[model samples]
Target: MDKERIIHRICALHETCPGNIVTEKEAISPELIGLNIFGEPLVGFASATDELFEAFKNSDIVGPWFLSPTEWLPEAKTVISLFFPYTEAVKSANRKATTHPAAEWLHGRIEGQAYLLKLIESLKKWFDDNDIKTCVPITDQRFEVVVAGNNFKQYSCVTADTFSSNWSERHVAYIAGLGTFGLSKGLITEKGMAGRFISIIVSKELAADPRPYTGIYDHCNRCGACVKRCPAQAISLAEGKDHNLCGAWLSKMGNLFKPRYGCGLCQTGVPCESAIPRKRRT
Candidate 1:
């Protein structure tokens, strides 16, 4: 229906959704069984025809493979971006980790993702019941994600650079006035960088939110806290982030942690961990 109604429904679902809670049957450890992964989500809206979507297709950005909202759904009129910040339990646990990912963070990465899908699926169903058309691009049949060290020819779109996807939730969130990018390449919102982003395109037209700042990295204070927190050494004040190195380190984490691998060290102990950092004076 309207933005207020949409947000209310989402928050209600989050509060009552069993998938949002880590069940004993699925937890990797006893302590994680009752852990809640995400807090109340932040939602933002953007016009499906935003010019920024065209800019994202530039080679230096997401490349030609990046699909705009309308490309995903021809009748798309609004892009609803949702940021689900990790619960305090999840962030606090990960902050205690150094070289490897905390078990709590691992569950957040694996099971938390499953909950995201379920949340969106339920939301989509509600829209369908209301006679509104919606598309969850991440779960769409056309979605394409090229991971590092993986072949891409299997997909119609190919790029020499890996570690990218056709539908980037972060970029979409930025367009929705959700936040800006930090030095770590993580989108820093009012709720912070330690979270997951997902979006849906709908036929319903909604007023687009105004971006409070102009620059892509406006929310980032360039404090370099993420640099010190990075265990993979994948981030720096000068070069920002090296995706290859970050990807390799994640691969190593996969070998060590198996089905639940993740390294959010750059996200947890940073100045923008839970909120936008105040800009430092030069």
Candidate 2:
């Protein structure tokens, strides 16, 4: 398909997608970005790695093509960094003044996990109908998928999606325009950072990454409000991310808190997201 039609179809899929702008292939600048779905191949739940990989196949996680779980497919020409913002879910659930308990973290966020699942399913169908292959955009979910297994550590697979040099494949989606680089661990879009944000890596399809996002980093005010508010004190002023504290805290809490979710202090800035409007009010 022509790039114009492919881009047009994707934009039409999302009312807020801002439509397509510059083509990615015509000019692959040094600043050019791409999604790296090649995480730990057999990393997810049990020996079901192949089965788990198949789930994303023929899915419209982004109107797509080949999915490279451990490496980018050489055949993939176009990469679509699909983004789904969680600001609304965060605002709606996070109505308290004091911070939530560690166990109750990420509470106010992810109210729309089910909605997102449906959205991905819908998009997958659309891509399948259009004959486009899609890849799996893994996040924390992949970690648990493996951890749930009886003997996860014994396997050759990793606990999560950790790539060479890049560590946990953090920059891939961000550079791909899925969202902006955030100091609080992951990327933050207009939707505000609340919970797991999936990156839909589109391939083979002719389309363009909507611009500005292509060469931008979310200008964190550096207020460090998240650092100050974090109950675990997991955030460090010198280092950008403190994986140890974050992972340990979440593990100990273990479904004892209010909403029974992951720690949210990092992204639950009381002031940062104020700029984002409260409700859609349909």
How large an RMSD does model 1 have?
A: 3.9
Per-residue lDDT tens digits for candidate 1, residues 1-282, read 799999999898888777888899988989778898999999999999999898877765666778988899999999999999999999999999888989989989999999999999998998899988999999999998755333322221222455687888988898999999888888999999999998999999999999998988889898988999888898888877777788789999999999888999999988899999987888
The Cα error of candidate 2 at residue 202, in Å, is 3.5
Models 1 onward score TM values of 0.94, 0.55
Clashing pairs in 2: 38-69, 38-70, 45-145, 60-124, 64-133, 65-133, 87-191, 105-262
Q: Which 10-residue span in candidate 1 carries the lowest summed lDDT?
A: 150-159
In candidate 1, stretches whose alpha carbon ends up further than 4 angstroms from where it belongs are 147-160
Name the weakest run of 10 consecutive residues (lDDT summed) in model 2: 37-46
The Cα error of candidate 1 at residue 2, in Å, is: 1.2
Kindly list the per-residue Cα lDDT of model 2 for residues 160-274, writing each as its tens digit.
3321221122334443444454545555545455544343434444434442443333445555667776667766556544555666666665454433455565566544442
